[model samples]
Target: MWGIEAGSVAQDTASGQYAGLAPSIDSWFLSQSASTASVSKMTAAREAGAVPMVAWSPEGNLTEIKNGQKDAQIISMAKSLAAYGHPFYFRPFAEFNTNWETYSLGRSGNTPQALYGAWRRVFRIFRQYTGSKSLFVWTVGYSGSISPLKTAWPGSDYVNYVGIDAYDWCTSSSWCPGDQYRYKTMLGALRQFDGGRPAILAETATGLQTADKGKWLGAALRTAQADGIRALVWFDEIVPNSNQPDWRLASPSSAQASIQAALKQPNVASPKYRDITTLESYAVSASWAKAIR
Candidate 1:
């Protein structure tokens, strides 16, 4: 549940003030892709000149640790980026609706076009390095209303999939605290924009539980089944030394039951929704090309 995709490992020192990080942190961050430890490293970097100052970019800047680890996640990204090149899944600072991380929070003067351009730069770099159909995903945070859709969207060539980062909150309020992000509910909303490729829960908070976590879990599954979202990823923050609960969800043993139960029901597949039957469809373009499977 906890994974770290380290790129160019850097020493956490501005001249020996001991930036609160451990030597291992420096040892790991400073490792390069070429080093024996980084023999298999890969990094997701944010191409400079892409996003505009009008927008915000946080987690979006996946520092291409020149010495990125050559593991599953890192290698996968490297393979995709080096092969398909630019215009890949440029989902930078998605889910602006949620104030979780600096990457995705609020927007003031930036237009979607400018945001789109920034993202395109990433994909373009990937394309330049990879190939076509790099499969870039533009996802939003979840468990609440989607406000970014109201803004401008990137051009057709730049984006491939539209997704959201939904968590399991009892009711649709804020983060998925007590009530886990019921899979069913999240899937239900995903169905609204079904055009197919694959509607995804780009990021999800799980493992932690409140009183009604189980209920939320049950409802989430049902919702996903009814809606047809194709994929989901549980973002269990497991970075060493960072005890901040913001990105970290509960990993307590008590919540294992709920986590196990959710994992068991994996086939919450969708056929991609088409047609603007609902008002929500109109807002979120229900098209196959818009969906990145």
Candidate 2:
């Protein structure tokens, strides 16, 4: 489905309302303290005809989670999600390979084993509640300096989808800092890691300051299609008090036009909340999806 991540559900809804094509999934972050509030947000999102994809991040370390210190909280969350009775996504510790996160490898004494164990512990708890329709998305950064992708994977049994969070920092400049500009190749690697599961661009966008953003977005969609990516979620908000570039499509009419045109195509999957059971159903063929949008 065509998804979007923003500061809040209302902000995402407003962006989509102005853009013509509304987002099918509203992606947002969550702390352990915000779990209950996330459930409320999910209800609102469901009523608004969108899925809530929560990036579940704990403020503490993964070692604590691995050791079952967070079991009580995890069980409570699992029960809440099961009661929601709608399909949503649960992405735990996204970009965990990066040092910026407390749960990441090499931080707070977290190892690859600790990350994997923590993920499995959470997954097992959620699975015990049979009514939950939450899909687990294992997301990785475009690049990792600490460990290889395989080292951090919690295994196929623990993962429902493979995802990558990447951005084109300088699509029009040859002198950009960092390696994320090579998102195409990075996405290719993500697909390989997917094995047979569906792949998603969990978060992505180009800087507004860059020229030819429309062209870049168009190309990115086409690349996603070719690489068999089931979904692409744009990171549509500008980060506050940070050097992160503005990725919103609300401005610069040309970029908006490009995405509106690209996303409206029949091949692109629209949100089918009811029939969305598996990857094949979610990633419908052009002939079947033509009437959806």
Candidate 3:
């Protein structure tokens, strides 16, 4: 699936519409509370012909969740999603091996056992309500060596898809003083550790500083296809005052052209291309009429 995690369905769909590409999956975040209010976003995505992929962060102690403190919240989410009645993707505690996440295995005294327990608990509850209609995605931030990713797996039975968030955060030696930035290599590693499940690039983008960014984008997509990735979602945001590099193709027009070329390939799925084109056209025409007035 060719997908994007961005501001809105219109925005996300527009990202690829010019190329006759629309997201097969529209990825978004569910806050620490795991609010079902975001169902509105999911509704919009579905209306536009895409499945919703929620990256949920159930903040606070993982052990507490394992011990059932968050059972109410989990059940609420599961029932709400089940009532929605359309298939979607649930990705909870993404990047669980990264130090930055509050629920990370080694952070705040969280153990691998706690992670496992918490995940299984959530998975079991969701299954009770959603059944096999929805899929549980387990995603990790790629760590080049000696990573806790495999150790943190909740098990094959609990997870339907395995994914990695691989970013090219380094272009200058100053940012990556150790020269450790590996975009393509990380994509290569995803297939090996997917636990025999379908693989996805959950979040990815090259830094703005990289030379020939357009070429890199094209090559990355081709690499993902070659690696047997079932889905790839571009992290196409330009956050204000953030440490992350600008990965939006909107800023540099040429990068969009390159992505367009890559997306033209038959393997890249864009189920909502017509809907996106209509939306884009309406917006443009509305703007033109306002200008003439």
Displacement of the residue 173 alpha carbon in candidate 2, Å: 5.9
Cα lDDT of model 1 by residue, 1-293, tens digit: 01111213221121011111111111122212221122222221211101100012322322221113223333444454354222223344465445554333243433344455545555555455455534556666555444444343454555555566655422332454444334445345444543343555555544333423434544555554456553343344445685433222233434435544543443321111221122123123422233212
Error of 3 at 13 (Å): 1.6
- Which candidate model has the greater TM-score, 2 or 3? 2
Off by over 4 Å in 1: 1-80, 83-90, 96-109, 143-150, 155-157, 169-197, 206-215, 238-250, 266-293
Point to the candidate with the largest lDDT: 2
Candidate 3 per-residue C-alpha lDDT over 187-281 given as tens digits, one digit per residue, 9 for 90 to 100: 45544555577677888876755345556666677777676666778888887998877877664565566666666665555563434333333
Compare candidates 1 and 3 on lDDT and give the better one: 3
RMSD of each: 13.8, 3.7, 8.4
User: Whole-model lDDT, candidate 3?
Assistant: 0.70
Q: Rank the candidates by TM-score, best first.
A: 2, 3, 1
Q: Candidate 2, 200: how far from true, in Å?
A: 0.2
Residue 33 shift from truth in candidate 3, angstroms: 2.2
Show where candidate 2 strays beyond 4 Å: 130-132, 171-181, 188-194, 271-293
The TM-score measured for candidate 2 stands at 0.85
Model 2 residue pairs with clashes: none
After superposition, which runs of candidate 3 have C-alpha atoms over 4 Å from their true positions?
18-20, 144-146, 170-194, 209-211, 272-293
